[model samples]
Target: RGLFPSFFREAQRREVLLEDLLYVSSAFERIAEATEEMLAEMEDSLRKPVDPEEFRHFWLALAEDLEREL
Candidate 1:
């Protein structure tokens, strides 16, 4: 029947959307974890003595790496 075909199509569309959403959610989780780890490392570095120029370069490189991962 026509109604049955439409129902199946809509269901398929919803399934695809759900899959996309899950993939995005996983990506966000990964990004968040990576960001948290980076922040913790920065915090630890702050607790110790670090050269300003060295820290600046390290921070910039970390930012670039984070941007690529995201």
Candidate 2:
């Protein structure tokens, strides 16, 4: 599924060009790539044992991040 088919549909109805959509989509593409890289790094770190306190801190920080907007 696409991220925002309805949004693109509306934009098209409003006469937005395909080039404009492609231009804006680059930002989403970059964000997705960066997120994948960060998650990969986190996964590599977690492959080994971690300190209990540090793990707790990481979870708390992630929760705080999720509580806010991107």
lDDT winner = 1
Span of 10 residues, lowest total lDDT, candidate 2: 12-21
Query: Mind giving the per-residue lDDT tens digits that candidate 2 earns over 1-70?
Result: 5859988888877675666788789988999999999999999987978799998999999999998856
TM-score of each: 0.69, 0.43
Each prediction's whole-model lDDT (CA):
0.97, 0.87
Please, what are the lDDT tens digits per residue for candidate 1 over residues 1-70? 8999999999999999999999999999999999999999999977998789998999999999999999
TM-score, structure 2 vs. true: 0.43
